[model samples]
Target chain A: MKAAKIVFGLLAVTFLMAPLVTILPLAFTSSDLLSYPIRSFSLRWFEELMISDAWRMSIVNSLVIGAGATLLATVLGTLVSLGLRRSFAFSGILKSALLLPMVVPAVILGVGMQITFIQLGLVNTHVGVIIAHTVVALPFVIVSVSGSLAGIDMRVERAAMSLGANPLRVFGHVTLPLMLPGVLSGAVLAFATSLDEVVLTLFVAGPNQRTLARQMFSSIRENISPAIAAAAFVIIVGTVVVAGLVLLFRAAAQRQKPSTVTV
Target chain B: MTASMATSRASGRGSTTGRDGSMAASSARVAAMNGASAPFIALEQVEMMFGTHRVVDQLDLTITRGEFVSLLGPSGSGKTTILMLLAGFLQPTAGSICLGGKRIDHLPPHRRDMGVVFQNYALFPHMSVADNVAFPLRMRRVGREEIEQRVTRALDMVQLQHLRDRRPAMLSGGQQQRIALARALVFEPSVVLMDEPLGALDKQLREQMQLDIRDLHRRLGLTIVFVTHDQGEALTMSDRIAVFNRGRIEQIGSPTEIYDRPASRFVAEFIGETNLMAGKVTTTGPDGSLIRLDSGEDMAASAADWPAAGNEALLSVRPENVTVQPVGTARRTERVNIMQAKVADSVYQGDHLRLHLDCGQRRMIARLDRQVADYAVGTQVDVVFQADNCRVIPT
Candidate 1:
């Protein structure tokens, strides 16, 4: 039975990792044909990605849009989480509405946003793409932040207040610091979500505002190049690094949790 | 707020002068001084309603400066609600609260200048012990040097100065509680409100902390409003206890007054173990009143609030007040009531024996000293109590 379980686990891992295994090595292939068996490995494709104007511009755009969307989403989502903590009549409905983007089809959101952006005269601009990405990234931020908020004891905030800290000072000194790990993880998730978003960028962005994910998508359709593989490699490594930092933050948070006494 | 500070400081000085005397005498002096002045904290007709449910209904309470008052009750009895109201965490639906004769009902919790220690300690996890104690001073924008000096002194007061660099998670429950106490007091606020602050400790630790808190209250001349469901804790630590039942105070008085002469049936049952006999007042006299029990026994009891003859009454007698003697060993004397009883059961406690006696159909408990001769099951005995030891409460 144990052997069968081990076999099944290995099969699952292989199935999940097969696509990355097949595609990543192509990024290091010397030939541009994208064949599996490479005669030699070269850094030419990586250098081309950095030197090409279209690819370089797309990389910069992705970073700019990702940072902007993460900042906007993290702030708004944390506020929404705090406000929703003390629930009112319509709070549940509002929360579900905010989370709608996570389940709604990305194509539908893209088509809807394209028309709205044009009406707002935000089309073909970096702001429009960032705003579009933020809408999709908000659910991840809210869910992460709300989880952290729930672990906190409300009495800690009250203790700060009783110790002569006003509302704003209590937030700054107590509540914000306690929930920092959650906020950091949520920001990472928001950035990763913005980095990979393609359909919304395709609908809302023009050629000048093309993001990395959009460029990769168009490259696959127009031409199969190793440089696209290099870009994918960079994104995958970047995501792993961000995820590692989040894990570190969570571990530190767990270690420092205050002892809760029960009577 | 400033006026309240002045009054508290004056009481602090007065207490310091009497520090060399006995604790009881010093506290009495403080109480006398406080009684001669206006109340430090006063709640006048305060009502707190939660939607359709009224948590605190038209309640009034007053705490004299330097007095430690405990709001004692069962859960849902509005004792904690009153504490929160006093701390400015919950606004009253009606009426007002005054500190040193200044109305403070509209002030926010921080502006009220009150320190509160929560049941769970509620220490900040991210802060060191010294920083936690220094939080109030930092919030007041005290200079860094003064903050350090005060934090050191506060930690010293709790005898936790060695643990100043450690986080709250690393401390034991008792140590964490001391940190919470130090943090609450470092600001030297006019009043300190504690909500079952030692409820999380074990029995021995809780008892020790109770003594420590009482000592602190006497030494610092602090006006404290404590809330606890534990009656023993209130009796041990409080100068005055307000026994609450269903959003109203059943009675409020000194611990001895509450225990020896409970104002109502609820207060009698809530405070400790007591034998309550349903009776009717048969005759009233200058010395005491005669009560005819429903079980066809007659007893004499002194009444704090005299009930007229032919009024319904309850006789409350603490078990320790009831003494058991071998049958016919002693004759009844004036102002003493005696009954022939059969010992149904006797449980040997550490320092005493709890005897359960049967007087006709009514059961009575007597706590006899361990040195007293044992009365086995079914042994005939006489149960005796003085009129002054039992109270006749009008029901």
Candidate 2:
């Protein structure tokens, strides 16, 4: 039974990693075109990617836009989660509306944002793309932060207040520190969301603001060069590095967690 | 509100005739009121409403400085609500609260300078014990050196100074309780409110903590409002106990007064074990009264605050007070109130043997000495009740 379970798990993992496994080896091909057959293994496509200004500029834009979107989404989502902690008549509706972004179709959101940004004179700009990415990333931040917030005993806040810490101080000292794990994970999720965003960037971003994903999209449509495969490899490696660092930090934090004191 | 307020207060009055009765209770209360320079905390007609559902209704109480008073009640009886109201977590919809002769209901919890030890301790998990105790001091912007000194002193009070560097999650239940107590007391707020602070511990530990808290209360001269549903804990630690029912305080008196002469049926049933028999008042005097039970048995009981002679009454007697004498040839003549009963069952309980007896159509139980041989079922026995132990409560 255990062997069967292990076999099924391996099958699931293989299914998930199949795309990455197929795309990763093309970057090592000697031929200019991305195909199965390779004349020889070479670093020519990587060199091409490094020398091209468009690819380098796209990487920088992606980083800048991702950071900006993450900052905006994390702040807004955290504030919303905190506000939602206190119950009110319309809180249910408000929470549902805020979380609606997570379920909305990306193409619909992209088209809606495009039309809205055009009238607001924010079209073809970094700010437009960042805002679009933030709209999508905000739901992840809210869900993660609210989960952490819900885990905290509300009485702890009251205890803080009774112990002479005002509301602001209570948040600064107790609530924020307790919710750090959630906030960190949420910020990382927002960053990843912004980095991987392409459909919204295509609708709103200009030539000057083309992100790495947008450049990759254009490269796929224009040509089947192995440089695109090289870019894919870099993107995959970069994502793995970021996620690995986050998981390592989380594990360290979990190790420091004290044993249960039932009292 | 005024009418209910009068009833709540009157329930504690006019019952000065128990073994440890009214005179001492009134004196203790009077001493508490005049003992301090002023009543440290006063709640006047405090009404708390959650939406339309009233949680606390026109509750009026005054706690003198340095007094240890307990609010005792079952769950949802509004005792904890009063503590939260005093701590400024819940706002009273209609009344005023004053601390140190100044109105404080308008102030937020932090500004009110009241400390609370939560039922679960609520100690900050991320902080070391010293930091947890220093949190209040830090918020008040106390000097770093002073905070260090006071933290040491607070931990020392709870005998937890050696565990100062340990995190709360690493401590035992008792140690965590002490840390929570230390944190609450470090700031030395005007009043300390503890909500079932010892409820989580085992029985033995709870008893030890009860004594420890009472000792600290005396030594530190702290004005404490303790909330607990455990009647024994309240009786052990409190100078006075306010018994609450529904959303109002049913009675408030010293522990002995509450136990010996409970004001109402609720207090009698809630405080201790009592065998209550429905009766009608037949004769009343200054010292005692005579009641005829619904079972047609006549019983002599201590005088209670009854409306009239023929009105309904409840005769409550503790099991320990009911002596069971085996039916014999001559020894039963000296007993004043005696009735023939058949032993339904008898169980040995280490220190005492409980005799469950049936007298006519009524079933009663008596807690007898362990030295007495157990009476077998269906054996005839004589159950005696002294007038001092039998209390007649007016309905």
Candidate 3:
């Protein structure tokens, strides 16, 4: 069994990592084109991307939207999760609605939101784009945090309450800390989703609010450049780092967690 | 919408003659009116409903100051619901509850000054043992020095002071339960409620924890309302037990009173191992009675509340109280309540022998003191119990 497990693990590693190796090295090609096995590597593309207005603006916009989406989704999702968890009212319908964005087609969601944003006079605004990204991102946050909350025994909350902390104090002191890893994992996913968002950005983002994915889309459509490859390299590295941190936090949280903690 | 239980208090009216319960009645009345000697924690007509099915029918219970009370029952008997109501988690559907002479039924759980230890220890995982123990103090904003002193003392009480710096995840199940207990008691609330606190521990560990909890209650003189489905636990830990059944109080009395003289058929069957024989009252006398069993033979079973002649009743005899002997014994004076039977099966249980006897149409169980000295299966024997040991309850 142990030997079989090792073999399975090796197979998974090869399957997951081989594609990354192929895609990543193309970023450093000395040519002004995308190719592997470069004759020489240079920071020329990266420097050129730094000077480009569109590239710079997209990077800044990604940061703004990513941070905004993370904060909004984490707060709203965490609070909603706590509410749904503590009470039986409307839970089934609420959970389904919150999870809908995760399964629905992004194109469909973008179209629906575009119409809504136009009616609300929010289309072509940064706030509109952030809201659209958050609509797609909130589910991930809710699932992550709520999954953690599910694993937590509400008994801990009662224990706090028994010790004389009221509802708000119990949430702030006992609950939020115990489930922090879960909340952070959700926030990471939300930020990462917004950072790579493209379809929603195209439908609703203002000229100033264009995301990295939107900028990359236009570049590839008009003229694919090594600068785009350099941006991709940066994004790939950043994503791996954030995703890795999330996996680590989740693993750490799960390792010490009790199986019967009332999930 | 919230409903609270307002159990009618035993009003301090009407004096009665006492067995040396003389002028004490008048003093007791004055005390009741003055709100003195009232239970530190009292559940008054507490009811809980799950949809329209009343899970906790009107329950009236009182825990005197510094007394230990246990709510004992099988699952779905609403023992845990009663504990939750006391903890302020479930709103009692009918009556008001009083804690130390103050109405606290409407108070939120946190403001009720009661500590609860859950079946699964609800220790905060991110915090160390000291932090978890100090949580109540921190919530109440006690001084840091005082918090330190109290946490250390509480940990010491549980003999876990050395492990105080460790997180709860590092503790064993028994240790975690102890920490839970210590955390609950450290706050020095007027009352502490435990909801099946030892349910998660192994048998040996559970036994030790029971003694530990009992000792703590004694040492601290704290009022406690412990809820458990384990009848043995209730017997071991409680000064008095409230046995629950189908959302109603089956019986409430001291442990031995509940065991030796149960008030109802449910209480008799629930508290211990017993052999029940449904019968009709054939004769009644001043000292004892004889009842005809369902198999049409008269057996001498006795209870104070034995019904009049021809009334259908059930007889409950404890297994250990039944004695087996060779048939046709000639002592003559010790032959009361004798039944001729054959031991159809026997199992040696090290300390006691458990015998299954086939007597006419009824099979009876008898627990004998000797394991090895027992009749072989299918051997003819006389199963006898004293008239006092055979208790009769109304069907």
Candidate 4:
């Protein structure tokens, strides 16, 4: 039974990652435009990617928006989650309302947001784009933070309070530390969402504030070049790198947890 | 969680009233007594309501300086609710709680100056033992060096210092509980509350932890209010045990008193196995009274305040105190209280024999030491108990 499970596990990994495996090698193709079973491989595409001003700007744009969205989503989501917890009067209703951004089709939210932004004259600015991304990011933060909140034995906070610390101190100390990993993880996810956000960005983003996905889309419309493939490859790599960094940070953070982890 | 121990450590403040040596002594006394104060913790006529139904009724209790009190009850008893009230997690709809003479009922739990331990230990799974112990101290803002020193001391007290660097997931249940104990104590809070901290352990481990917890209390002299549904655990470790029922404290006393002289029928039956035989007072005697059983037998019993003549009462008899004799034993003398019985069944448990017998219309069990040998099931026998040993409780 164990051997069978191992076989199935490897098969599943291959099934999910095999497409990326194919795409990665195609990125090195000398002839460009993603032809399978590359006839030749060279470093020209990598060099082309390095020299492309458009690609560099896209990288910078994605990072900035990812960071901004991460910061906004994490803070808003964590606060809302904490408020929602132990305040059930409107939390249930409010939580469902907040989650509508996540479940609603991205195009619909984008359309509504576009109209709202046009009225407010925010359609062509970086800040407008960030707010839209942050809205999508917020639910991830709330869901992550609140998931951990439910795991916390409420008794611990009470225990702290009875010990002498006041309410804010409890939040700053006991409650906050325990829930941070979930919060941090959520922010990373929000950053990932914003970084890859193409559907919403297509409508809400200003031409001057073009994101990586938007840049890639425009480049694809114009023509397929080896640099575009290189850029696409770089994007895929960037996503992986960001995810890896989040994992590393989380592992380090957990190593220093105050609760007993080892036997 | 405390950033420093001082932040979460609620002061009794009574020492401030005294000067010089008296002040030191006052602080020392409170520390010695269990960091308790003049009515530091109060459970005022507290009631817990679930819609219109009251699960816990009005309860009034005051825990003084340095007392090790255990709330003992069976499942569904309101003992846990009272502990929650003291912990500031549950608000009483009708009453308020005062801690250190300040109203704390409306205060959130973080401001209550208490340390709590749950049955599952509630240790953070990602943290090492030392970090877990240091958590509350950290929240209270104790200096880093002091936090380390106290964490070390607390860990050593529980004899888990060697495992301090290990995370909670790696420890055994007993070790986790010990780490929890250290964490609760490292902050030096005024009171520590434990809710069935040892309930998850096996019997042997449970008993061992009971001793360790009691010893820890002695060494630290920290005031604690522990809740457990186990009667043996309560009697084995508590300085005083409060018997709770439905939602009220039925009785409170030392182990001996609670065991030997229970205050009510609920307490007597709840604490241990007892043979409750209905009896009625027939006449008053010098020391107590002459009672007649519902079985139409006259029995003499000594107790304070004889019930009115023919008033119904219950006789609480422990199985260990009940003796059984062969049908022809001459030990059944004239002065002895003997009744004819048949041994309906006998269970042989190492070192003892449990004999179930039927005497007249009442069922009685006698726990006889192994030396007495075994009585075959269905054999006729004579049952006996000393008059003073039977607690005749008025119904």
Candidate 5:
């Protein structure tokens, strides 16, 4: 039975890893077109991804949009979580309404936002795309921040107040520091959401405002450029590095935590 | 939903004072005459409401300057609520709070300048002991050098100077409690409020800390308001205790006055172990009163405050005050109230032997010194109650 379970686990891992195996090696091929079985190894496609203005501009757009969306989502989500933490008559309903964007289908939201952006004359603007990304990214921030907020014992805040801290000072000194880990994780999630976003960008973005995901989608459909494989490899490696940094940062924070003393 | 909120608000300041506001004023006047020039902290007709529930109603308390007063009660008896109100965390629905002859009800928590030691310690996990103690001074914008000096002095006062660089979680429970105390005192606020600060420590540690805190109270001459449910802690640490029952101050006096001359039945029962007998006042006099017990025994007792004759009364006798003697040893006299009782159970405590007696329809416990002859269960005994030791309170 144990051997059968091991075989099942390996099969699951292989199924999930099949696409990466098929695509990763193609980026190293010498051929201009992304064809299967390797002809020869070359660094031409990676060089193309770096040197091409269009590709570089798309990467810059993705970064700009991701940072803007992340800032907007983290600030608003944290405020909403804190406000909802206090008991109020409508707090439960308000939380569900704020999370509605996550439940709605992305295609429907994209179409709706496209129409709204056109009427507002924001269809070609970075602001339009960033706002759209923030809407989808908000739920992740709220969920993460709310968990941390709930974990905090409110008596600590009361203790601060008793120790001569005003409300704003208490938030700046105590609440914010305690919730930093959750806020950082939420911001990273928001940035990732915006970087990988394609459907919403396709509907609302102009050629000058195209994100890296949108650029890759067009490359796959129109030309199957080997540069696309190189871009995908970069994205995969970048995500891993970002995630590893977050883990390392969290571990450092954990180490700074006070150890319980034995009598 | 609104109804529930209203209900909670009312219940939060829940209990009504049976004797009314005038009684509180009289008590405050009495406290003011206890050698203090003026009342340091005065709560006048304070009422707290959570929705429609009254958690604290028409409450008035007075604490003298440099005196350590403890609010003693069971859980949900509004002792903690009173502390929160004093700390400016909860606003009174009606009436005013004054500190040092100035009204402070309108001031915010930080502006009030009162320090509070919370039940759980509530030390910041991110800061070291010295940093935690320095926080209040930092908020007040004290000079950097002054902050360091004060923080060092406070840590030294708690004998925790070596651990100043350590975080609170790195300390034992007793050590953490001392850190909390030092942090609260480092700012030198006029009044300090403590809500069961020693409740989390072990018995030995709690006793040690109690003495430590009492020493601090004396050397610093600080006016402190302490809240606790433990009667023993209140008795040991408080110069005076305000015994609360259902959010109302049932009585407030010195520990001996509360133990030996309780103002009400609740005070007598709550403060210590007692044998209570239901009776009626048969006669009233300047020196004492006569009561007829429900079990058909007529007992003479002293009453500081007389209830009208024929009114229902409760006879309160401390277990230690009741004397258990051999059946024929007592020289029966009218001056001594005696009863024929059977020893239903005799418990051998370390310093004393406790005899649970069955006297016909009533039960009484007598705590006898260990030097007395041991009375086994089912032994016949004569219980003697001196008139001076028994108090008659209107029920």
Candidate 6:
């Protein structure tokens, strides 16, 4: 049974990783045309990504939009979670409504947002793309932050108030510090979400506001070069680095936790 | 503000004296000033309702300055609710609270200037012990030098200065509890409210902390309002105890008064283990009353609440007050009530023996020293108790 289970797990991992395994190595190929077997390895495709005007512009756009969306989503999501901490009669309904963007099809959200953006004169702008990305990223921030917020012992905040801290001071001194790990991880998730978003960005962005994901989509249709593979590699590595930082932060937080032994 | 600061500085200096010598002098001063002035904290007709479920109903309580009062009851008995109301965490639905003769019901918790110690210690995990102790002073914008001096003195009060640099997580439960105590006292608030602060500790640690807190209360002349479900803790640490039942106070008095003369059957059963005998008063006088038990026995009980003739009453007798003797060993006395019974069971405790006696249709228990001769099952014995030890409580 154990052997069968191990075989099943290997099959699942292979199935999940097959596309990344086939595509990532092409990023290092010397050939201009993307091929299955690499004749040689070179840094030329990566250099093309950095030196080409359109690719360089797209990468910068991705970073700008991702950071903006992450900042907006994290602030709004943390506020919503704090407001929802002490539940009211409509709290469940409000929470479900907040998370509706997660379960709703992105195509539907894109169409709706595109119409709304047009009415608000936000279409074909970086602000439009960032706002679009924040709509989808908000749910992840809310979920992560709410999980950590729930884990906090509210008595600690009460203790702060009893020690002569007003409401704002208590939040700054106790509540914010306790839930910081959650906020950091949520920001990372929000940035990653905005970095790779394609459907909504394609509908909302113009040619000048093209993001990395939109550039890669057009490249796949028009050229299919190794430069596209380099962009993918850059995104994958960025995500891994961000996730690693979050894990390090979590480990440090765990170390600072008090020991549970009763004396 | 200047006058209050001077008084606080004076008390801070008083705390620096030797523990033994200062305890005597401070406690005597406290006793002398206890009831001579108005109450330090007063709750008048306070009612707290949670969506129509009344947690505290028309409650009135007063704590004199320098008195340690414990709100004792079972869970859901409104004792913790009272503590929360006093701390300004939960506002009473109606009525008012006054501290130092000024209405404070509308103030927020931080503005109320009261310290609260939670059951789980609730120390900031990210802060060092000194920072936790210095939090209130920092909040008040004290100078850095004064903050350091006060934090050091507060940690010294709890004897935890050596662990000032450690986080709360690195400390044991007792150490964390002491840090919480130091943090609460560091500000020298007008009142200190503790909600079962030692509930998490083991029995031995709890007993030691009880003595520590009682000693601190005496030495510091602190007015503390403590809430605990443990009757023994209240009896040991409180100057007066308010026994709560069903969102109301059943009885409130000194420990001895509440124990020796519980006003109701609930107070009698809640405070300690007592054998309650149902009876009707046959005769009553200023000194005592005669009651006829339902099990066909006549017993004398001291007067309680002035029970008139033929009123239903309960006779409460502590187990330790009853003496068990061999059937023919005890002689009848005028003031002692003696009954003949058969030993149904005997439980050997470490320091005492619990004898279960079957007398007619009722069962009575007597706690005797372990050195007393053991009685076998079905052996005849005499159960003896003085009339003064048996309290008559209204049913």
Scored by lDDT, the top model is 1
Query: How do these models rank on TM-score, best leading?
Result: 6, 1, 2, 5, 3, 4
Span of ten consecutive residues with least summed lDDT in model 3 chain B: B1-10
Candidate 1 residue pairs in clash (backbone atoms < 3 Å): none
Model 1 lDDT tens row, B1-395: 12122323436435433333332333422463346667778899999999999999899888788788999999999999988988888999999999989999999999988889999999999888888898999999999898887787788888998888888999999999999999998888888999999999999999999998887777767788999999999998887899999999999988998998898899999999999899888888767788998877888888444677888999989999999888998577767989999999999999889999999888999999989988889999989999888888878
lDDT of 2: 0.84
In candidate 6, what are the lDDT values of residues B147-222, reduced to their tens digit? 8888878888889988888888889999999999989988888888999999999999999999998877767767
Query: Which segments of model 5 are wrong by more than 4 Å?
Result: A1-11, A33-35, A249-263, B1-33
Q: DockQ numbers for every candidate?
A: 0.46, 0.43, 0.41, 0.31, 0.38, 0.49
* lDDT (tens digit, per residue) of candidate 1 on A3-120: 9999999999999999999889889988987777888999889998999999999999999999999999999999999999888999999999999999999999999999999999
lDDT of 5 by residue, B1-395 (tens): 11111211111011112112121111221332345456778999999888888889799988886667999999988999999999998999998999889999888888888889999999987788888999999999999898998887788788998987788778999999999998898888888899999999999999999998876665555678999999999999887899998879999988899999888988998999999999998987867778999988999887545778889998889999899888988865545788899999989899898999999989999999989988889999899989889888878
CAPRI band of model 4? acceptable
* Shift in Å, residue B30, candidate 6: 5.6
On DockQ, the stronger of 4 and 5 is 5
**Which portions of model 4 show Cα errors greater than 4 Å?**
A1-23, A32-40, A50-53, A246-263, B1-43, B96-112, B124-127, B135-149, B186-189, B219-221, B284-286, B328-336
Per-candidate total of colliding backbone pairs: 0, 1, 8, 38, 20, 1
**Comparing to the true complex, what docking class would candidate 1 get?**
acceptable
lDDT of each: 0.88, 0.84, 0.81, 0.77, 0.84, 0.87
User: Which stretches of model 2 miss by more than 4 angstroms?
Assistant: A248-263, B1-37, B328-335
TM-score head-to-head 3 vs 6, winner:
6
lDDT of 3: 0.81
Give me the iRMSD of candidate 1, please. 7.1
Shift of residue B318 alpha carbon in model 6, Å: 0.9
Model 1 residue B344 CA deviation in Å: 1.9
Kept native contacts, as fractions per model, are 0.58, 0.55, 0.58, 0.44, 0.52, 0.58
